[model samples]
Target: MNADRAETVAILALGWLASNDELGPVFLGSTGASAEDMRRGATDPAFLASVLEFLTMDDAWVTAFCDATGVGYDEPLRARYTLPGAEQVHWT
Candidate 1:
């Protein structure tokens, strides 16, 4: 995914997370981001990358977000790597 498409996916994921009552607080707590912070972070690629990181941590979250957003299940991970600080690690 290109940066723009990745950002769009991240934004979709953010919207999904925001509307999820159960996961919304969990995300905020995990990231230490307040509602205000999230609002402000929407346009920040690094912050959006964090959002993708949080979503990709759990398969269920990924599935739910993908399902809700009508995106492919693998899109979040692809989008994450395209963002600011999500380079894939190699242990070879």
Candidate 2:
């Protein structure tokens, strides 16, 4: 995905997380982000990447998110790779 499309997916993921009663608080707790932080972070590529990162942690979460958003299950990970802070580390 291109950066623009990746960002759009990340924003969708954020909305999904925000509306999930069960997982919304978990996300906030996991990321240490307050509501205000979320509002501020919406435009940050790194933060959006984190949202995708969090979303892809569980197969069920990814499945549910994809189902809800009508996107492919792999799209989140793909989008993550296209976003900032997602560069692969080369240790060779």
Residue range 1-92, candidate 2, lDDT tens digits: 89998999999999999999999999999999998887877899999999999999999999999999998888999999999998879999
Over 4 Å off, model 2: none
- lDDT by residue (5-92, candidate 1, tens digit) is 9999999988889889999999999989999988888999999999999999999999988888799998999999999886767999
Q: List clash counts for every candidate, in order.
A: 0, 0
Candidate 1 RMSD computed on C-alpha atoms after optimal superposition onto the true structure: 1.6
- RMSD in Å for all candidates: 1.6, 0.8
Instruction: Choose the strongest candidate by TM-score.
Output: 2
Clashes counted in candidate 1 amount to: 0
Query: Backbone clash tally for model 2?
Result: 0
lDDT of 1: 0.92
- Candidate 1 residue pairs in clash (backbone atoms < 3 Å): none
